[model samples]
Target: MKFDKPAGSNPIDRMRIVGQPRDRVDGPLKTTGQATYAYEHTEIANPAYGAVVGAAIAKGRIRAMDGAAAKAAPGVLAVVTALDVGALEKGDYNTAKLFGGDRVDHYHQAIAVVVAETFEQAQAAAALVKVDYAPEEGRFDLAKALETAKPAKDPNAAPADEVNGVGDFDRAFAAAPVTLDAQYTTPDQSHAMMEPFASIAAWEGDQLTLWTSTQMVDWWRSDLAKTLGVDKDKVRVISPYIGGGFGGKLFLRVDAVLAALAAKAAGRPVKVTLPRPLIANNTTHRPATRQRIRIGCERDGTITAIAHESGSGDQKDGGPEAAVSQTRLLYAGANRLTALRLAVLDLPEGNSMRAPGEAPGMMALEIAMDEMAEKLGMDPIAFRVKNDTQVDPEKPERRFSQRQLVRCLTEGAERFGWSQRNAMPGQVRDGRWLVGMGVAAAFRNHISLKSGARVILGRDGQVTVETDMTDIGTGSYTIIAQTAAEMMGVDLDAVTVRLGDSRFPVSAGSGGQFGAANSTSGVYAACVKLREAVAQRLGFNSAEAAFEGGQVSAGNRTVSLTKAAAAGELVGEDGIEYGDLDETYQLSTFGAHFVEVGVDRYTGVTRVRRMLAMCAAGRILNPKSARSQVIGAMTMGVGGALMEELAVDTRYGFFVNHDLAGYEVPVHADIPHQEVVFLDEADDKSNPMKAKGVGELGLCGVGAAVANAIYNATGVRVRDYPITLEKHLEQLPAVA
Candidate 1:
C-alpha cells in the first residue's frame, strides 16, 4: 500500500486490539530466562568462549605479539592476532580501526581475539598474549579542533559544503533591540545499553551462520561477507532478540567479525564478547558538539533572526551535527542561517545514538528559548506559542501535515498546572530546597522507512506474522501480532509473532523511533494480501468476504480458516511503500516537557523533583509501551541533563570512564516521577498506521527542560551539559 495522503480511519484505528495496552508477548520468556541471548546459547554443546584484547594506545602501531605463554595456557584453543587474520576489511559504516591493523587509529582498538574452551581461559589468555605498541600524539579536543575545521565537501553535490541561507542574518541581529548570543556544549555520550556487543559464529562446510546482537540483520550479513571475503548467501545472520540498541547496534561491530575469524581457526563455533569497559572505549559514541546559537527577537518576543551553527567531528566521510536542521523549521524567523562545520578529532567513531541531532540540539536550543522568553518577560510556553510556525520557515510554500505544537503546549500547560510555577528564581522554597519549573517545546522530524512483513496462516487456525523487525524492548512482537489479528478478524491470542531472523522479510528495523509504525504497516500490508488469498481459496468472492471470528463468509456460505489453511498453509508477503506525501507536507511530532527541579542551597546540587510530558505523536499503536518509551526517554534525558557524559581521556585518546559504574545513567533514585499524556491525534501523511515514532519523541527536548529548570532554581545559566555542581558552586548564594 502506497501511503500518499494523511491516514483516514483504518483497521488499526479501530483500537480493538492494536492500540490496547498489551504486555510484550516475549516478556515472560525473558523474565524467566528462557530467552537465550547470543552468549548464553550453550545449547549448541561445548561452545567455546572468546575474549578480545585491545591495544593500549589511541594512535599507535602494534609492533609485535608473543602468544607463546597464552598457547600453553590450559584450555586455550587458539589465539588470533591481527597478523593471523588476513584480508579483513572494515565495514561500510565503520571508521575507527578494528582488527588487522598494524597502526591503530584510536585508543583501545581491538588488536587480537582469543578463543578458548572456557570464558575464564579466553580472558586469562587475552591478558597473557602481550603485544608491543608505538604511541603517537593525536588531537582530541573538538573545541580546539574547530579552529582548523572546514565545511564538509559533499560528493553528491558540487565540491562545496551543503550550505543554505536566507536574508541577512547579521543585519537582522544587529537591528534587533533584544538579542541573545552564546555557545553551548554537549559532551559525547555512550549508548550504555544493558547488553554488551556479542556474537557466536559457527561454520559447517563453508556455510557460516552467526547468532549475534545487532540492529540491522541484512547490513550485518552483507558486511560480514564483504569483510570475510565470502559470498553473501553463504552466511546467515540471526539476531532473534536484541537487549537494546539505541543506535549502537546499527553497524557491524568487532564481535561478529572476530567470532567468524576465530571459528575458522578453531574449527568450531566461537563466541566472542567485548568486555564492558572495552565496549565503551572501542565502540562508537554520539559525538560531542560545540554549538553557537544566536537569536534576535523583538521586545514582545517575536523572533526576527535565528542561527544555529554546530561543530562536531568524525572521519573525513562523516557529516556534522545536523543539529541546525530542526532550527530552520522550528519557528518563524525571517533571517535564519544554520551552518555545520566538521572538525577532526581522535575520539571514538561518532554516530547516531537515540534522537541523535535533535536530542543534543534541543538540549541547548530549548534552554536558549527559555532564556529568550525570560528576557522578553513572557511565560516560556506562551512565548513558544507566539513564535509557532505552521509552515517551514525556509520553505513557506509547504505546509505542515498537522501542527499541534501550540495546542500541545496550551493543553499540556493546563493539564500540568504550569501556572503554579514561580516566576522568580530561588524564591519558591520546598522545605530545604529551591523549587522551579521549566518548559521546552519538543520537536523531532517524523521519518518513514520502507518495510516488509509476512503473515502465514497455519493449519491449526492460528495466524503467525514474521518479519526481520527487531523488538529491542519496544513492543514490536505484541504490536505486530495485534496488527495481524485485527486484520484477520481473529482473537489476539490466536496470533503469533516471529521476528529478528534474516531469513524473514526485510523491515525498517528499529531506529529513529520509526520501528513501531513502519514495521507494523508492513504487517498490515501483508495481512491485506492474506485476506484476499483466503477468500480466493475458499471460493468466496474476495470483495464480499467478511473475515470475522476466524471464519470467512460470503453469500451465506462460511468456511473455517483452518479448513482453508489445510490447503497447504496460505502465505502472504508485501511491503508498505511510501510516496511523495512527505515532500508535500511538513510532518513532525510535537510535545511539551514540563520539569520541576530542586537545587541544593549550599552544595548547588540539582535534582529532578517531578516531570511531565504531553505528547502529540499521531496514533499511538500501544499506549502502555508508548508510555514506557516516553518515560524511558525522559529518564535518559535526566541523565543527559545531570550525569551522562563520556569522560574523555584526551591524554590517551579514549573514553576513560568506560563502564557502568563510571558512566552514570538514571537509576531509580535519580528519577523522581515522570508522566506522559498522548493527545488524541493521527497524521495521514506519516503512514497508513498514522503513528509517528514516540521512542525518540519523548527524548527530543527533555534535557533542555531539566537544564532550564535548574537555571530557574538557581538563577544561573550553565551552557554545558550535565550541569554539574562544580559548574554552579561559585554562582550560588553564599551561606551565612
Candidate 2:
C-alpha cells in the first residue's frame, strides 16, 4: 500500500467503528491479573532467576571479584562476570561500552550477573560477590564539559551542525520595539514506566527465545543477534503487552542481553528484572538540557527573528537533544537558527524519552512566548494566532496537509473561559491563595515510518491482525481491532489483534508518538487485501462487496463470510510505504494548553486548580485512548514542572536519586481536574489514518503553562526546571 498522496474517503470514512470511543479489548484480562508480563512468565520448564551486581565506583578499575562465596550459597547455579563476556562487543546504539571491563564509563555499570534457583538466592549471592575498585574522576557537568566537546559525527547531517541566521538576529532584536530573551534549564528525567526492565531468555541449542517487556521487538532481536554473534533469524523476541515504555523501553537494555548470556552459561532459562534503584543507573535517561531562546517581534506582534539553542551531555558519537527541530518550522520567522551541542559526560548514557526534544524544548520555549506576550501587554492566544505559519519556513513552496493550530487556540480559549482571566497576577485572589491563568502553544511533528502487518480471515468470520507493534498501554489492540472491523465491514467483536511478537511482520514499534497512527495504517493496508480475497472467494464483484453483520454481499448476490472462509483461512500481508510527501509538507500536530494555578504566599507551594488541552491532531482513531495518552502526558508534565528531577551526584558522576523514592513523579493529589478536547479535523498527508499524533502533544508546552502560571501568581520567575520552592523561597515577598 503506497501512501503516495493524500488519503481518500474509503470504507473508513463511514465513521461507524473507527471514530467510536471504545474500551480496550484486553482490559479485562489485565485487570483480572491474567496478563503475563516478562518476569511473570513461569510457564517454561525449570525457570531460574538472575540478579545483577553493578560496579560501586562511577569510574574505576575492577581489581577482583570473589565469586567463590556466592557459588557456595544454596541454589546458586552460576555466576557470569565481565571477564566471562570475553571480548565483549558493544551494540550499535550504545556508547561507553555496556558490561564495561578494565575501565568504568559510568557509576553502577553492570559488573556481573548471578543466576540461581530463586530470586532471593540470586540476590543474596550477588551481594556476596564483592570487588575492589580504584576510583577516577569523571565529568558530569554539561556547561563545564561542553567547553571541550565536539559536534556529533554524522556525515549526512546538515551543518553537522551550526545553523546561523540569514539576517543579523542581534540587530533585529535590538531594533525590535518588543523582544524577549531568556535561558531555561531542564534537568535529566527518568521515563519511570510502571514496569521495570524485565526479560526472560531461554536457549534451545544455538537458537534463543526471549519473552521481554520491550517496544522495538525487531530491533532488540537484531541487536541481540549481533551481540551474541549469531544469525538474526535464530533469535525470537515476544512482547505482546507492556505496562508502559515512554521511550524507556524503546531500546534493548541489559536485562534481556544479560539474561540470555546467563541462561546460556547456566544451560537453563533465566529471568532478569532490574531492581528499581538500578533502572535509573543502568538504563538511559532524558539528558538534561540548557536552552536559550531569543524572539524578536514587531510592535503589532509579528515575529521577525527567533532562535533556539539547546545543549546536553552524552558519550562521544552521541547527538544533542535536537530541541530546535520544531523551531525551524513552527512559527513564522525569516531570520531564525537552531543548533544542538553535545558534550561528554560520565553520567549514565542519555537518550530518548517521551517527546524527547520537544518535551523539554517546549518547556522553555512556550514559557518564553508567554513572557513575551505579557511583556507586550497582549493576549497569549492572540500572539500565537498572529504568528501561525501554514508553510515550512525553511521551504516556502510546501504547505501543511492540514493545520488547525489557530482553530485549536481560539476554540480552547473560548471553552476555557479565557476572558475570565484577569491580566493582573496576584490581584486574582481566590480565598487565601493568589490565582492566575496561563496558556502556551503545543507543537510536535507527525513522523511516519515503514510498517507492515498480516491479517487472517478465519472460517468463523473472525479477523485477527498480527504486527510487531507494541501497545505500551496506548490502546494498540483496540485501535487495531477497530481498523480491521472498519475495513472488513464487521463489528468490533469480530476482530482480534496480536502485537509485539517478532514472529509477526515488522512494524514501526511504538515510539515518537507515531505508533498509533502509523502502525494502525499498516493494519488497514493489510486488511484491504484480505477484503478483496474474501470477495473473490465468494465469486462476487469485489468492488461492490460489502462485509457487514457476518455476511458478504455484492449487488443481488449475498454469501456468509464464514462460508467464504470455509476453504481454509485467507491471509493478507501488506505494508504502508511512503513517498516524499512529508518532505514536501510541514507535517506536524498542534494544540493549546491552558492552566490555572494558585501559589501559597507563605509556603511558596504551587497547586494546580484546573487544566485543559485543545488539540488539532488530524483524526481521532479512538477518542478514549487518545484522551488517555494526552491526560497521562499532562500528568507527566505536572511532575516535570514541580517534582520530577534526577539529582546528579557530581562527586561520583552518577544520578544520585536512583529509586522512585528518591525520584518523584505525580500522583492523583499532585494533579487536579484535567480535560482534553480534540478539534474535529484530518490530515491526509500524514497517512491513510488521516491522523497526525496526539501522544506527545499533551507534553509539549504543558510544563510551561504551569511555570507561567506560577510566575503570574507569585511574580517570581524561576528559570531552572522543577520550579522548586528552594529557587523561589528567598526571593518571594515576605508574607504580610
Candidate 3:
C-alpha cells in the first residue's frame, strides 16, 4: 500500500491493542536463557574457530606476511592472508576495506584469518602469522588539521563548491543587539554495545548460510555477497536475536566476511568473534567534532540569526560527522546558515552511533540555547516556547505533520518542578552539594523507508507475520505482534512474528529509529490484504467488511475468521511504499529533557538527582517498551555528559582506551529517578500506522540538559564534552 496522502480513519485508529502497554512477548525466553545469540549457535558439528589477525600499523602497505608458521601449527585447518585472497572490492557501505588489502587505512585493520578446531588454537595460531609493514605518517589530529579543512565533497556529484544555508546570517547577526558565539567540542565515542561482532558461516554447494549478530540483515547479506564476488541469491543471513547494536552493527564487518571466507577455505562451518580490544578499533565509531554556533536574538527571546559550522576528520572520500544538519530546521531563525567542513585523518572509520547527527548536534545547539537564554535573562523553557514554529523555518510552505514541541516543553517543565529552580546560580544548597535544574529541547528527523512483509492466515485461526526486521534488544517482536493482532481482530496470542530471516520480505531493518514505524506499517499493509482475502472468501464486500472479535461482519451477516479460511490457508504479501507525503509535510519527532543535578562542594563530582523526558512522537505502539527506550537513552545521556570518551593516540592514530575497563560509562549509582511522558499524537503524513520513531528521539539533546545543569550548580561552564569534573574543579566556588 502506497502511503500517498494522510490516512482517514484507518483500522489502527481503533486502538484495541496498539497503544496498550504490553510486555515483550520474548521477554520470558530471554530472562529464562532460552533465547540464543549469534555466538551461541554451537549445534553445528565440528565447527571450526577463526581468529583474526589485525594490523599493528595505521597507514602503510604490507611489506611481507609469513603464514607458514600458522599453517604448520597444531589443529590449524587453514590460514588466509591478503596475498592469498588477492584484492577484493569493498562494499558500498564500508569506508575502509576489510580484508584482502595491501594498504591499511586505520589501526587494527584485519590482516589475516586463522581457522582451527579450537578457539584457543586459532587464537594462538593467529599470533604466529607475522606481518611486516612500511610505516608512513598520516593525519590524526582534527584540531591541528583544522587549518587545511575544506568544504565537504559529494561522491555522486562533480567537483564543485557547496554550502548548506538559507539566509544572510552575517548581516542579521551584525544588526542584532544580543549576540553570542561559542565553540563546543565532542570527543569520538564507541558504541560499546553489550554484544561483540560475531558470525557463523557455512557453505553447502554454492549456497552460503550465515548466523550473524547484525542490525541490518539484508544489507549485510547483500554486502557480503558483493565483497565475496558471489551472487546475492547465493547468500542467506539469519539473525534471530541481537544483544545490542546502537548503530555499530548496521553494515558488513570483518567478522562476518572473514568467517564466510574461512569456512569456504576450511571446508567446514567456521565461527569468528572479534576480541573486545579489537572490536573498538576494527568497527566504526562516532567521529569527534568541533562546532561553532553563533546565535542572534532579541530582548524578547526571539531568535533572528543562527549559524552553525562544524569541522571533523575522516579518511579520504569519507563523510563528515554532519553536526550542522539539525540547526537548519530546529528553531525559527529567519537568517540561518549551516555548513560542514571535512579534514583528512587516518583514524578508524567513523560512522553512525545512537542518534548520529542529532545526538551530537543537540549537544552543542541546546547548550547554546541555554547560554542565550541566560544572556537574555529569560527562562529556558519560555525562551524555547516563544520561538516555536509550526511550519518549516527554512521553507515556510511546508508544515510539520504533527508538532507538539511546545506541549512537550511546557508539560515537562511542570512535571520536573521548573518553577522551584532559582534563577540565580549557586543559591540552592543541600548539605555538601549544590543543587540545580536545567532543560533542553529534543529533535530528530523522522525517516520512512520501503518496508515489506508477508502475512499468512491459517484455517486454524492463527496468523503469522514474516519480515527481515531485527529486534536488536528493542521490542520489535512484541510491537509487530500487536500490529498484526490489531489488524486481524485477534488476541496477541493468536499472532506469531518471525523476524531476521533474509528469505523473508526485506524490511527497513532496525537503524535510524525507523524500524518500529516502517516495519509495523508494512505488517499493517499485509494485514489489509489478508482482510480483503478473508472477506472475499466469506462472500462479503471487502470495503464494507468490519473485522472485530475474531469475526468478519458486513451489514447483518457475520462469519468467524476461522470459518472464512476453512477452504484453505490464505497468504497475503505487501509492503508500505511512500509517495510525496514526506515532501509535502515536514516529518520529525520532538521532545524535551529536564534534569536536576547535585554537585559535591569539595570533590567537584556531579550526580543526577532526577530526570524527566516528555516525548511527542506520533502514536506510540507500546508505552512500556517506549519508556524502556527513553530511560536507556537517558542513562546513555548521563554517560555522554559526565563520561564516555575514546582517548585517541595521535602518534599511532588509534584509540588508546580500547576496552571497557578504561572506558567509563554511567552505572546505576550515578542515575537516580527517571520518568518518561509521551504526549498523545497521531501523524498521518508519516505512515499508515501514524507512528514516528522514539528510539533516537529519546537521546537527542539529553546531554545538553546535564551539561546545563552542571553549569547551574557550580556557575562554571565547560565547552568540551564528557564534561568531566577535572574541567571545572578549579573554577568551582570555594566552600569549607
Of the candidates shown, which would achieve the greatest TM-score relative to the real structure? 3
TM-score (C-alpha) between model 3 and the true structure: 0.98
Span of 10 residues, lowest total lDDT, candidate 1: 152-161
Model 1's C-alpha root-mean-square deviation from the true structure amounts to: 1.9
Residue 438 accuracy (lDDT) in model 1: 84
- Of 2 and 3, the candidate ahead on lDDT is 3
User: Global lDDT of each model?
Assistant: 0.85, 0.86, 0.90
lDDT of 2 by residue, 543-603 (tens): 8888777788888888887888898999989989899898788788999999999887777
Question: What shift in Å separates residue 130 of candidate 3 from its native position after superposition?
Answer: 0.8
How much is the lDDT of residue 502 in candidate 3?
Answer: 99
lDDT of 2 at 302: 91
Candidate order (lDDT): 3, 2, 1
Q: Please give the range of 10 consecutive residues that has the lowest summed lDDT in model 3.
A: 153-162
TM-score of each: 0.97, 0.97, 0.98
Q: How many collisions per candidate? A: 4, 0, 0
The lDDT leader among the candidates is 3
Model 3 Cα lDDT, one tens digit per residue, 202-247? 9999999999999999999988999999999999999999999999
The alpha-carbon lDDT assigned to residue 540 of candidate 3 equals: 92
- Candidate 1 residues 493-548, lDDT tens each? 89989888888999998888888889999999999889889988999887788777
